[model samples]
Target chain A: MATPYHLKIVTPERTVFDGPVTYIIVRSTEGEIGILAHHMQIITPLVPHIITVYPEAGNVEQFTIGGGFLEVGNDTTVVLADSAERASEIDVARAQLARQRALETIAQAKPDIDLIRAKRALQRAENRLKLAGHSAGGMTSA
Target chain B: MAAGGLKEVDRRIKSVKNTQQITRAMKMVAAAKLRKAELRAKKARDYFEQIQAVTRRAVSKGGAQKLVAPRTVQRKGFVIITSARGLAGPYNANVLRQAVAKMQEVGGKNAAAFAIGRKGRDYLAHRNIPILQEFLGVGDDPTLHQAQAIAREILQQYLGGEVDEVWLTYTKFINPLTHEVRTLRVLPVEEPPAEESGAERSYVFEPDPETVFNDLLPRYVEVVIFSALLESKASEHGARMTAMDSASKNADELIRQMILMRNRLRQAAITREIAELVSGAEALE
Candidate 1:
């Protein structure tokens, strides 16, 4: 059995998760990376994506995180995100609305609107929707 | 005459009681908001400290040359934060006074302000200080998006060379009853001293050191602004809560005194009526 390590996911508004986890997977700017107990220390920026965590053998948790950074230290791994929400906590309707709005804004291509911000918004909405959909589908992937 | 006096006292008591109700309600509201604000501030502080540590390590490695390098001060920018409304005791006044003092010391004519709240905007405007931008209606709970927007404005000014330096002024929350106005430099990011280990560890940077540092610098600025906003918010609520509490207490005291006076006046009027009746009865006898 792999040793469990302390994992904490924090956002500007609040700390979303703080507990011990046996394994965690997150997508960094470079690529997808997984951390286990006693992983080497490194810091990398994260892209908007879903983070999967295994607290125990059978229990699984997922969260959608906005772009931020992840730091693996000596004893703890920390995910510092601009925003984070549990998969179950994600509001599908809101995400869908946001995605629609972002698409409209990008399609219009108004000079006044920031295209980059709109694109990022779309990415976040999609990420949330994907996570929410994955969880609602079933425990098949886990 | 006694009856008229009694009526006046009664009216005064009613007014004082009304004022007391308002202050009491305001105090309760502020207290509730303060609880939420304090929790947010605590969480933000943790993130802020972590980011600061990471930035320090990055700076110690001599990355992000443009941002870490300090230039000669020519023109300065001040980001002043204050509450939107008044009646929060000296909450707005304390920060504004300190901000103005700093502006004057830094060369008033050369300083421009990025006002965060209406109070700061109006105060600086009255002083004829050049306001580069004004953000109003932050409301009770400020979101990270608002902080990001403000940071973007400051970054634009700094990067465009419009301002040589930038300073942030806000009230720092110490406790529920204590808060102090603080001013700290934001632009030309201060390089924190390296860790005491004295041994350089070759840590892995995902893409490259330069890229990570560059991204980290701007993010650091955003985090600083966000955390400061949280702290200032907590302080504002704390100040308002304390202010309203005392105001309510004063109103209570005033109401008590007025009620006492009304009772005394009523008694005096009754005594006067009784004396006149006795005198009339004695004259009839």
Candidate 2:
């Protein structure tokens, strides 16, 4: 395998992922970005989305992170999540329920109540549910 | 002064020494808490930078009037300041003094006070500095919940148009060794200089920009308060450690002086007895 780059995923709650990874893909406010050994130094804000990590010598790992930022410089990719949970760690059932409730809330919210925020919440929960291999795909990503 | 008056000084010295020891222990505990506080602060910065970047983009796109600027300054506002406890030094006094000067300045009459930390709260109250709210016993160890509560209070006030501005006064921890008293503008949403969030990266929000920012902005405010709390906490510990170290040193010097005084008194007594003895011998001869 090519020399693995340093990858660190951190949240205020915990350090979710830290290791060397050969390949990784991150979804940000910009879009999905693939990182390898020699990516330029980039610092950008993250949106609610999924992250897929292909370990240097193992199967891929997945995660969903809330709004935060990423500082990628040198051979390092640091993800600072407002909140983050590993696909293996997040309870799929709970995430689905959260997705349902948020969607319902969005449907019933007052006019002044923000539709975008409710949608983002739905997306965040659904992102986790789908990544965790839920069969339903949250009624959006079909 | 009589020789026995020295005993009173000795007793006072012992009491001061005990107090210093307790202060020293408290300083250590604060130092440990400061470490975590710093991490939370640093983590919070990343979140702010991201939100700020996005907000700047949205604002710059010519949607200023459409989006609500809750913090746009109008009349009066609240400034929350946090200070330290267990006074062995100017730790609390320095911050409160700075707070006084600031409240008199930019705040004018409109700038109300939300003084956190006991010492700060008392100082403002005593001066009859119109305090909108006060949070005491926040302690050297501050919590995220504390930050949230503070945010909620500020938000309620801002949305209700009760205040048009907001600020915070506390010491900022530059390092474990450096703490500086500061008053940070918390309301009117002083947007820091923006980084180039990609224009190409930007697309319409799923529903709209205003909708996204409205939710994010409040969270952004929460995060900012959280950061301040963290900064103040670290500063408190740094100040405590410094204060305790100096206090302990002063006590050591005091003890040395006390010992020297006792030694001199004992020597004086010895000389007097010797003089009496010599005189008695002479009389016998």
Q: DockQ score for model 2, please?
A: 0.13
Give lDDT tens digits, candidate 2, residues B151-242. Answer: 88878887777777777776677887787888777655554344554444333442355555565556656766766777777777667777
Task: Kindly report the docking quality category of candidate 2.
Answer: incorrect
Q: Interface RMSD of every candidate?
A: 1.6, 7.4
Show the colliding residue pairs in model 1.
none
DockQ of 1: 0.52
User: Candidate 1, A65: how far from true, in Å?
Assistant: 2.0
Question: Over the stretch A72-97, how does candidate 2's per-residue lDDT look in tens digits?
Answer: 64666677677788767878778778
Individual DockQ of the candidates?
A: 0.52, 0.13
Deviation from native of the Cα of residue B75 in model 2, angstroms: 2.9
Task: Please give the lDDT score at residue B70 for candidate 2.
Answer: 49
Per-residue C-alpha lDDT of model 1 across residues B104-183, encoded as one tens digit per residue: 88756799999999999999899889998999998888888888888888888898888889999998889989998999
Locate the minimum summed-lDDT window of 10 residues in model 2 chain A. Answer: A133-142
